[model samples]
Target chain A: MTSAFWAVYLREILIMKRRILRQSASMAVSPLLYVVAFGCALGAAVKVGDRSYLEFLIPGLAAMASMTQAFAIATEINVARFYFFAFEEFQAAPVSPFSYVLAETLAGVTKALYAVLIVLIIALLFGTRLNYGPAFWGALLLNSFSFAALAVALAMLVKSHADQSLLTAFVITPMAFLGGTFFPVDALPAWASAILRFLPLTHAADAARAGAFGLPPSPLPFIILACCSLVFFSLALSTVKKARN
Target chain B: MIKTESLKKSFGRTRALDSLDLEVPEGELFAFLGPNGAGKTTAIRILTGLSFKDSGKAFVAGVDIDKDPLKAKRLCGLATQNVNLDSELSVRENMDIHGRLFSMSAKERRERTRELLELVELWDRADSLVKSLSGGLKRRLMIARALSHGPRLLFLDEPTVGLDPAIRRRVWSLIKTVNQKGVTVLLTTHYIEEAEFLAGRVAFIHEGRIVREGTPGEIALEVGKWAADTFQDGVLKSSFFADKREATEFLAAAPGGGTLRKVNLEDAFIHLTGKRVL
Candidate 1:
């Protein structure tokens, strides 16, 4: 059983990697358009506060790239399992359900990591003026893993592939906007700020910005993010149990 | 090596298996013959420990499937009806991964993979991608994968449902070779000829019940001699099989017994299930 668990995990990683590579052309093209259009063209016309709009937009683009890919990876993994082939091979294998879920989560997180790295390299090459250290990388990884778990948990609860697209519109897209990826939560009304504070990505972006600028994240927000991650991980695992049953 | 006592399973409003009892010796080729949607796959899943039984008990290789599924699964190999091989991997890579799942070391995996590949006549295409192989080659690869870890018992569901006649016969020959190696084989198929040719003992299942169980010839004999009738003018003529002496005796005594010929498993299957074999 131990060997079976590790074998499945390793095999899952390779499968995910191949899938990501298949989408690599799109990944490369889409991000270039976003960075070039929003950062170069729009930056020439608009200024946010005293900073160049392009400079301010670079961080958000990085965060958006990470968050969107993370969600895509998590959601597609379960969708493939349930709707495509029904995981017939894994179902017939000796591996346990817990091990299967763990492997999937790791695979999703790794795919998100690949997306983040590709986008970051592009951002750097285009002279997007990013100043962040290892601390920023650490926060990005944490945010990706936590969000991947949440996405997978939600995906498991849904019964149809169409529900995934619905979720992006109703849940994921709103979180990105409200999470302060593109604008500061404080710029919104008081009630909106209060609501946005509950989003995991808000805390993640704030922590990332703080670390990148050599500032410290508020301890309270850090605790909140950690607690939210734990909750998401637990929910993901519980959903796996329901799915297997 | 396998036993099930009043095994039962239900899927919502449908009852898949009900009070079914089965026993297979350590090394026998047993076939489960049934019509489509007749609970064949459900029963096979329970025996393989891949699904739960609503009630009763199932044991494979002395291990209770529900209580010790891991142990039970380790003792058996399963080939599903749908082709489930990873299309992205080569035949050898697929076997290597299967061996790794069984905890075989890399060295052992290579050796066992070679042996199984040769056993299936797929050694020449070991490095080719599964998607590039012909249907027969892929099916052979699935068989080799199932035996990669040297499992004592193998379970196959609908092993030859969609193959051409030539390929089906080739697969049957391969199955005979595997059985000759002393491995216990359990298979379910709608093809009566395949079962009649390869099965040592056969079970006729219909509506979640075992209608009859025995050697194919035994069941055929017990079902009584069958006859086909034709009409000539206003009279009906029939032909069938009976003992040469019995035919003479019947002819001398009463005229209604009719002529007899040997009955095969297909006739027996139709008699017990009352369903035509496709």
Candidate 2:
């Protein structure tokens, strides 16, 4: 990578380091609450194919956390653009648009990985030890890459800081709930399941649950996620190039 | 060194730059003087490679900006009108990042950061969070950061817009010090006195065109040495004279009393374009 890419990435890392403790706490809260509210409420009495519902919920939460946290980088980008005006600093420098998008997307991936680590710790405390083989991580990484690239593209398209919240509400929030994170998509009607299959998060959650359950890995969801990552990354590059103009 | 020919840019139906032309020699403190929406910032943005022009050619330090923008950008440093520093980072971190973007070595970045911070007299505040500093300190840091890469050309766009008079004068001295060290400076400001005091040459831009360009003294001389101002029906009008005696006589015999003073660059702009820069 170029030094300019590292410079931009280093800046994001430095800011993250300064807020690590608070960020970790924020990342840990919702998963812990979900485990308490849903796991304590329905886990012992429910079973999906002979296992407790808590075991099923853990991987789904992990998938959801990866998507949400990776997409959270948009808030940081919006703050830099609207409040601090720091995006202009990059524009005035010798950094290329591709280098800029790559660095920011990787930074978003780093944040997602950090949030996933918190979910893993929460699962350990709940005594839910699911399989964590290479396939599980590969699916998770692709999922994070896809959402982070999407976040960078959407960030470039937002007009104001407040518009960022609208994107989260309209795009990300709906996907988080409907992408089979809370329940099995197969339980839904055939039409609903078919439509949900189009969402990248649906493939991510399915692949993650399959890996965590020690099932044989299927390549379809991974392929879908890889395609999503490529498309979103290309969109990020084009939007950033337009933003510079 | 910088040069542009027939530069044109439009936003929807509004023209931001219209056949703009400019030339700045190496090591000269050149200023673009214009009011708001007069294309000063737009021209600066295009020349620095931050924005593209519609139809034009621009060269920075002999490198075509459109052909090799990275090379052209590497030769210039820009301090925008707004305070665009990262408020969460320390003063030192901000400068360090800028140096790294220019591919400076760790050791080079360290040495340059110290040199620039000390030059702006902010070395003691290098570890302070940018948000914790006063506005004047933040402005000084912006200038210091722009010079971190040791660029051949420096662009300051309204560097003292929100500063108090005292702080503004301090920045003026810093700018002068930077230029004296052999770095060419291109400054854009609507403050007529700022251009008069700091720039070796001044260009008056109105509606995206250069109306007048010359040394401060040479431009002021075009409107004569003296000016007599008169107010009638809530409208202020000014007349220029080659001699103070002529101005005083006109002021004394005028229908209503008027103020007489030596002419400045603003007077020359008003005389040439019949518009107030402020």
Candidate 3:
């Protein structure tokens, strides 16, 4: 399991290693602009909690970045299946489907970590500092794992590159904007808040916010995240098995 | 090293393999000849564990495929019809990834990578990305990567489907060399010349069943030693002859023009199945 799963994960890292600069640049561009435009326009004046809006926005962006970067693996998986035939190679090899999915999920998590770094850099340039502790990282990892597993399940369901792009546009994009990234779910209308509370990203953002402020997050969000991650993980594994044979 | 019995597979209403049986002795170069859309690719998929057999048994190097797919897979190396190498990675990285999938040690990966790259004559291109390679070069690299783990059985599915004649012969020689090193090879090819030149035994499959199976010489003998083609009534018909002396006399005594040539595997296939091997 170690060798085979690492083989798949290491292959992605090896490829990413060559294009690390381009990847970092791409990740940096959006967060950089968001920080400058949003932070300058309204962030300095508004305060989400004990910190300025800019500092508050840092954790939100961290959550969003992890979700987005981790979910980005859907496109890569589509490319491997449709264009490069690399997924078929894995299927034909001696590696188990579970290891392959786990390796891909780890790759997605790795990307999320990189994106977190990029967002943190943007926060530093703005002189916005907050708690960078284990709790913060644990919440961040949970968010990435949940979303990356969802990405793998979605990749298996999608049949074409166009469908993959559609998912990014319709599902991921809407969730990034509406799932408590810009405003707290508690701040929404009572009826809207009821529905928003159920979104995984909403819990992710809330938990991550608590971590960034050096406060202990409640166990409920982590429990919900664990459940969602397990569901997505199982679905992805079964879908992958179905696709192979 | 490879055997399947009563193998059955289907895609919707389309039956890909219907009670198909195949056997290849250790170190034998076997070729499966069939037209497009036949069960050739499907059968290979099941044996290699890329796809499942509906309700039959397949054993690879004594490992039952459906029962122990990983063990079966570990015993064979499949270079599929399509070049499936990671185009973004360097040639050596592609080989390295495969070695790691088989759980080879670091030292073994290094040594095996060198050995395979040199064997396929791609050692110089080891650091180059796979996307940078020409079609012929990519084909060779895939073969090298397929052989990276040194499995007892090698499955080559149309290894030279689109290459030019010169490159095809180069690949053919490479395959022959690998087989000579005691690797059992189960290959499929559209080129009758390829099978005739490389295979120790050949099987012709059509509509998911083996229509004929035998040595190249033995199969070709079904259409006799010589063949005469006559075009009349806007249609071409072929006649086989066992005696060359009689065939010569038969062609010379013809009142109308016709062509006579040596009976080959393609002729035998056409005569038996009413379909050309190509």
Candidate 4:
């Protein structure tokens, strides 16, 4: 089972490695823009908590980057489904469903980590040193898994590139901005905050900020993210079986 | 060997397979002939563990497919109709990944990859990306990848679907070579001549069930040795005869001239199912 999981994972890694420059470029754009357009401009004017806005912004950027990169698996999955037909390849093989899910989720996490590195580099250049502790890594990982699993489920439901793009546009993008990636959910109206609380990314941002400030995020966010990951993973699994039919 | 008893599958209200029973004896080169949507692919997918059967039994190499899918899948290899190989990967790399998925050791994978690539004559293009290869080469590589794990039973689902005649013939020879090495092969094809040339036994499927199945000669003999087809106002009426002498004689007596020819498997299929295999 482990070997089978590695087989699927390694295939993605190999493709990513072959096209690393192209792959990296897709991730590079947002960080460059965010750091330049927001970080430098707002650094002196704003204070987010006990620290500078740049420091607070770095973790949020990391959280958002990881979330988007992880969820980018949906686009990759759509390509495999619509073009390469790799999903059918795995379907025909003797691989178990759990292994397939594990492999794809890992691929999403791996891509998210690569984005994390990009954000780290940007932070370094901007003279922002945030926490590099276990809590930070753990929250980042949980955030990746939840979003990646959502990507897998959505990938299965949508049939075409246009539909996938619409999902990215309407669903993922809204979640990215509203989930407190760019600003504080606490600043929003009570009813607006209630809805944002339901999104996994909202908790992810909270957890990420806590970790960046060298504090442990509340167990509540971790629990919610864990439940979300499990639910999304289960949905992806059923969708895989449905797609075969 | 492959066997399915009362196997049923449905997608929504459309029954793709309905109590379908299939039998292929050990070491036989069996061809499943059917028109589009005759349920050939659905059956293949179910038997190969890519899809689940609604009810009933399917076994590949003696293991029940539903009960032991992974174990049964281990005994079978499928070269699908489409060129499903990863286009970005080299020919060898595609085969290597298949080997890895099946848990082949490094040395075994290396050696098997070499042997199968050479067998399919893709060894020369082993280092080339699959997308860069011609259609024929990609099909050949798909076959190589399917065989990398050395499965006992091989399923070729319209393996030569879109290839030109020459490349089709080349694929035919490769399949023959593989079958000769004692692998039980179940092939599906719309090309009637392909079935006649390669199949030891042929089965005709229509509306999710087998209409007729036998040796190519046996099926053809049921419709007699000869047939004559005469067209009137874009409609063709056919007549079968016990021999060419009788067929030609009938053709001569017909109101309009008719084309008399020796009955082939396609004629036999049309005679039995009233539907063209294509």
Candidate 5:
């Protein structure tokens, strides 16, 4: 059983390697511009709560990269499986539905990992300082996997590429903006804050910023994100098991 | 060996596989001949455990598909109609991954990759990206990849649909070699010539049902004894025999100027399935 899991993990690594080879240039351009646009220009003009714009927007942009890359990973793979090759290889192989989904989710997280590392390095080059520690790394991983699972689950349910864009535009973008990525959730209305507290990214962004600034570690956000991950994972697994019929 | 008993599948309101019954004996090259939308793909997918059957049972290598689908799938290899390989990887990489999926050790996987690539005459091109290879080379790679784990039974759906004649012949020879080594092959093809060349026993499927099943010769005979005609001086010339039995009688009765040959699977398929091979 452990061997099977490793095989799935290695396959995911190989898949991500291929993705990086194919899209690294395009991916790098987006994050590079974000670093210049928000971290430099916008940082000079605005104050996010009490922190400088560069200090505040840096963690949020990093989290944004994590979410978009995670979602892209799942959506593109699902499209390739259904429309490009029709997933014949996976279907004929001994790998179960759960294993296939697991591989895809891992691949998605890897994409987010790639995007985060690139953006983080660029931020550091531009005079942005972060408190790097184990807690920060842990929080980053948590956010990547949570968003990947949710994205894959959503991909399985939708039927068209245009629909996927609509989902990202109307759904994921709103959450990123409102999930305390750009600012603290204390500024939100009471009802919105109550809902944001349940969101994985809200906790993810909070955990990330807290760790980056050398603040005391808190378990609430991790607990909430872990619960969200569990829900998303189960939903993805069941969607696949049901969709095959 | 493979067997399906009253296997049925439905997509929305359309009955893709309607109580289809199919069987392929051990060491035989069985062909599923049908037109587009004839449920040939649907039946093959269900039998290979790629799709679920709405009702009935499927077994591969004596393992019930529903009860032990993984076991059944492990016992068979499928080369689908579309070239479904990972284009990002090289030919060798694709086979290696398939080997890993079957849980082969690294050394064993490498060894098997060498053997299969050599068998397909693709060893020299093993490191080439799949997307870079020609259509014929890719097809050969798919066949080799299918055999990487030593599957007892193989499925090739429309194995050589759109290739030049020479390349098609190359694929045919490779399939024959695999079957010669005791692997049971279940192939689906729309081309009458392909089915005739590869299948020891052919089943004619139409409208989601097996309309006829027999050896190619038997099917030809059933369509009335087939006779070959030759052209001499731009004029058609031939001799007709009574049936499959009259081959000897006609040889003795008519001294050969040009010659007369027996009918082929193409004529039999047209007679039975009532569809062109296009």
Candidate 6:
């Protein structure tokens, strides 16, 4: 079981190693554009709390990057399932469903961490220095873990490549914009804030922003993110087993 | 090496396998001869632990698949009908991963990969991406990957489904070589000659049940030694006889001239089911 886990992870690492340059560039493009457009051009006149808006936006951008990059693994899974038929190879092997899901989810977390590193690099270049403490890292890891697990479960349920795109459009896109990434969720109406509180990314963005600001860590968001991770990971295991049958 | 008794599987209202029973002894090259939709792939999938059976029992390499699927799976390797190789990776990487799945050491994996690739005559193209290889090369690589773990039993489902005749013959030779090395092989194919040429024992499956099972010569003898095909009013009619002289006499008495040939697995299949294997 341990060997099979590493075997599956090794394949992903090899593929990522070959495409490192291209993937790094792709990861950098969005955050770089967001810094230029929202942080530089629009932030000169606005203030978030006592600091400039760039400082606040940087942590939110980090939160969003972790979500998107982690969820991106579903595209790879779908391509393997629909076109290359590589998932069938694993199905025919002796690898357990738990090992397969764990390996793929870890691969997704790896990609998410890489994207977060790029965001930090961009933040440094923009003169927005934030605290890099354990709380910040914890929130980011939990966020990535939750979304990556969700990606695997949804990848198994989607019937075709088109359905995957629809999932991204409907599920991930809405969460990205409305999950308190661009602005404060508390600034919205009471009803809207109540709804957004249920989103995992909302807690992630809040915890990440608070950690970056060097504020006292609150355990509520961490607790919520951890619960979400466990639920999604369990769902991933079930879906993969169902796919095998 | 393999056995199944009263195995059954169904999808909705359709029965993919129904009360199927089979046994392949160690070191024997067996063939499941049937047309499409005859439950050949389903049976292989169930036996290999890739699928679930509705009822009945299956054993591989002395392991009960339902009770201990991982152990059974480790004892067998399957080359499916589709070319399911990781096209983005090189041939060596593909084989290496399969070895790792079976928990082979790095040294063992390297040695096995080289040995199997050489056996399949693919040593020279080990670094080439699978997508860049020809259809025949991909099939050969799949076979080599299947054997990289040194499995006691190998299941090949339509290993030569869409290849040219010359390439198909080359694949046949590879399968024969693997079987010669003492691996129990269970093959499924619709190609009549593929079974007749390679399998030591062949089972004819139709609509998810085995109609006949025996050696190629034994099953062919069940129909006849010779076949005479005559066309009357644009329809082809076939008649089988045990003696060459009897077939010649029947051909002579036909209203129109016909072709005479030796009986094959297809003839036996058509004689039993009244349908062509194709």
Evaluated at residue A128, the lDDT of candidate 2 is 88
DockQ-based class of model 3: high
Off by over 4 Å in 3: A42-44, B245-256
Each model's lDDT: 0.75, 0.92, 0.89, 0.87, 0.79, 0.93
Model 2: which residue pairs collide? none
Residue A203 lDDT in candidate 3: 86
lDDT at residue A180 of model 1 (Cα atoms):
74
Q: lDDT by residue for model 4 over B146-207, one digit each (tens)?
A: 88898999999999988999999999999999999999999888899999999999999888
Task: State the lDDT at B202 in candidate 4.
Answer: 91
The alpha-carbon lDDT assigned to residue B8 of candidate 4 equals 92
Q: What is the DockQ of candidate 6?
A: 0.77
Please identify which of the two predictions, 1 or 6, would achieve the higher TM-score against the true structure. Answer: 6
Q: Higher-DockQ candidate among 1 and 4?
A: 4
- How much does each candidate deviate from the true structure in C-alpha RMSD? 3.9, 1.3, 1.7, 2.0, 4.5, 1.4
Q: Which 10 residues in a row give candidate 6 chain A its minimum summed lDDT? A: A42-51
| Model 5: per-residue Cα lDDT at residue A132 | 64
Clashes of each: 6, 0, 0, 0, 0, 0
Instruction: Give one digit per residue, the lDDT tens place, for model 6 in B1-278.
Output: 88999999999989999999999999999999998999999999999877889999999988999889888888888898989898878999999989988999999999999999999999999999888999999999999999989889999999999999999999999999999999999999999999999999999999999999999999999888999999999999889998999999999999988999999989999989998999
- By descending lDDT, how would the candidates be arranged? 6, 2, 3, 4, 5, 1
Q: Per-residue lDDT tens digits of candidate 2, residues B13-126?
A: 999899999999999999999889999999999998778799999999999998998888889999998899988899999998999889999999999999999999999999
Instruction: Locate the minimum summed-lDDT window of 10 residues in model 3 chain B.
Output: B248-257
For each of the candidates, what fraction of the native contacts does it recover? Answer: 0.36, 0.86, 0.92, 0.72, 0.56, 0.78
Q: What are the per-residue Cα lDDT tens digits for candidate 3 across B180-256?
A: 99999999987999999999999998888998999999999977999887776888877889988888787777667
Candidate 4, position B50, lDDT: 75
- Which scores better on lDDT, 2 or 5? 2
Can you give the lDDT of residue B30 in candidate 5? Answer: 96
